[model samples]
Target: MDYSHVRGVDPAVADALEGEVDRQQNTLAMIASENHVSEAVMQAQGSALTNKYAEGYPGERYYAGCEFANDVELLAIDRAKELWGAEHVNVQPHSGTQANMGVYLAMLDPGDKILSLELSHGGHLSHGHPANFTGKTYDVEQYEVDPETGYIDYETLAEQAEAFDPDIVVSGYSAYPRAVDWERIQDVAESVDAYHLADIAHITGLVAAGVHPSPVGVADFVTGSTHKTIRAGRGGIIMCGEEHAKAIDNAVFPGAQGGPLMHNVAGKAVGFNEALQPEFTEYAERTVANARALADTFSQHGLEVVSGGTDNHLVLVDLRPSHPDTTGKDVEEALEEAGIVLNANTVPGETRSAFNPSGIRAGTPALTTRGFDEEATREVGELIVRIVDDYDDQETIDAVAEDVQALCDAHPLYD
Candidate 1:
């Protein structure tokens, strides 16, 4: 994708667009929720399907001129079903949060109770942060990971579910590193006679690649982002049993969303087709391997690695024990200056404000997408530790910045 046409029409907007492309080409993207999609997926996302207004599902539309739109959506849905092994799949949602919203609308009435993990403990806002509709519309209670181990306290969660007796129990997380025990969580939800909705927004690709335990069959509803680890175009997906298919489709169409982004649906189809290839499994495996290498590097350097290590594509590093005075924000800014882009994250049993949390979260999905292996990831990890160890050291920052550029060049995204 060339933005030359855009540059001819609108220079300023084209400049920013090209700058973003250059940024990705030149920098290391370690953000856990991000990945680099193929140029095929990009082309599809930027296709003419964006002009269509497909207001309903395939074979049934509320508008005319949707024959090709129907084909695109059906293809996306069919590929998604194969990818996640769901009896039913909805590919219409504009984002992961909307996918969750679709499930919520289908299953729970307003004012019903919701039990989910705390955001500070690695949960997402859609899982019931007070600011999101999940908290405001429903009665929300939170479960937490064990302070010492940085793992979910399943027994406590079960006990709390029995006590709170929520209508739905939400598992999965935004920053969790360890593999989730979906069956265990489902047992808790079953004991409380509650529905289990596992939000795998961060690990869609891992689940599809068989690199992580899937929640599709274990939970009553499984929601995910199409983009994160899935490397699909930016959208949301829901997987559920055949019994709930109608309700979910209705909830997504009439209840929550209007017209689906057909262009994004095309991208999802292309990406899912790519995922079904054998190389995608290799990519997923390499992603997890890189994360392990990153965790080992951080742990060896005396940083507190939450849950000790990772079984997935991300690692959480608590800065407290290693550098008690430094905040995650400080390291985030320093690393960004050095062109190693990731995010500050809140740790389990967090003592500081969420804005300036005590931890940094790193992931290897994007790096792995750029063809980085465990060895290359370890080098990146070593560079991160050095910067976090001395965030203000300009000489060290400059050196790391140069190295980051070299790594980016080595694994050129656009090329």
Candidate 2:
């Protein structure tokens, strides 16, 4: 078979790769869940470690030639424990979903009740989505944020926890804008005698950088992605209290699947090391500042920001009032035409389908990492607002997109 065309390694593919790089270099990426990994992390991911496949934990590899691989993996685990203040760490899961699954398989029995935040109110599908393993394997109960305030209603959640009597209480969110009340969640989990699992996938970097409160002391288990604000390779991590260390390790390894991605683990170690640097703290802090600046700009332009505003790296903008008949899809398309990249998210109480949501989700982590600040964020925010407000004006939108490209050029990624 002539597999040359399928492999995408020829001239056409090379052009495509360059085009994608150009796109990233030119566009303002505001997806809250995405980030730009560092050169060191990238180097580690593409290193010689990719050749090895040690099918078990460090120092117990099935393969004979894994001495160096063991060292890298063990270093990643140790750094993760120190960074998050966990008694033990597992840096092997392929993704955030897999990390959560490992925890469930380790502790909970089939049909045991698991309480988590409602998906629409800012929770990951892996927490309890009906189509996910979490919902299929367990008796799932959900708590939601206040519809009006867009913040978690702690009192309401406490009442639900009291009523459901779940075996595990999950604390985490995908689109939440405000800080989580970890103390309250810990108290509730303690009262119910439920194990508390905090999935700090979105805020782990902030927590590590001290911009957000650490969930380590509050939750019995904490899981996070090495990506997002951490700016590492795409992988999951499980950090646990001493009591659950053995169970957590068993769940991640023999309980879940076999083998770990040695390459990604190496990248994770580099990212963890980078995160400990003074510059990374400044980067994380700037991410928060940029988010707030963008949110303030939106409010000034009369766009209704979900939860009123943000204290972190992302903001969910409610577009219902500004463009009554318009969907987030329309605004997203308009902005894309203007070279501004972001996701259309479903706001709480959204009547629209997930495919065409009523809200636009924007963040500043990528931009801040690219050296953007308050002024750049404000300019970007105004451009976003203008496009959404006058979505029908193609010429104006394109003109503003020109401005966006200019700004992106001034502050290039990984420069």
**Which of the numbered candidates is closest to the native, going by highest lDDT?**
1
RMSD (Cα, Å) of candidate 1? 0.7
Per-residue CA lDDT of model 2 for 1-415, tens digit only, reads 1334434657677667667778888888888988888878987997898899888887777889999999999889888877778788989999999999999999999999999988877899999989899999999999888889899988888889999999999998899999988899999999899999999999989998889988897899899999999988779999887888889888988789787889999999999988878898999999999999999999999999998999889999888977778889998988888999898888888888988999989989899988998998999998998898888898889889899989988998845
TM-scores of all models? 0.99, 0.96
At residue 120, candidate 1 shows an lDDT of 97
In order, candidate lDDTs are 0.94, 0.89
**1-415 in candidate 1: lDDT tens per residue?**
5899999999999999999999999999999999999999999999999999989888889999999999888888899989889999999999999999999999999999999999999999999999999989999999999989999989999999999999999999999999999999999999999999999999999999999999988999999999989999889999999999999999999899899999999999999999999999999999999999999999989999999999998999888887999999999999999999999999988889999999999989999998999899999999998899889999989999999999988888986
The parts of candidate 1 lying over 4 Å away from their true place are none
- TM-score of candidate 1 versus the correct structure, residues matched by position: 0.99
Point out where model 2 deviates above 4 Å: 1-9
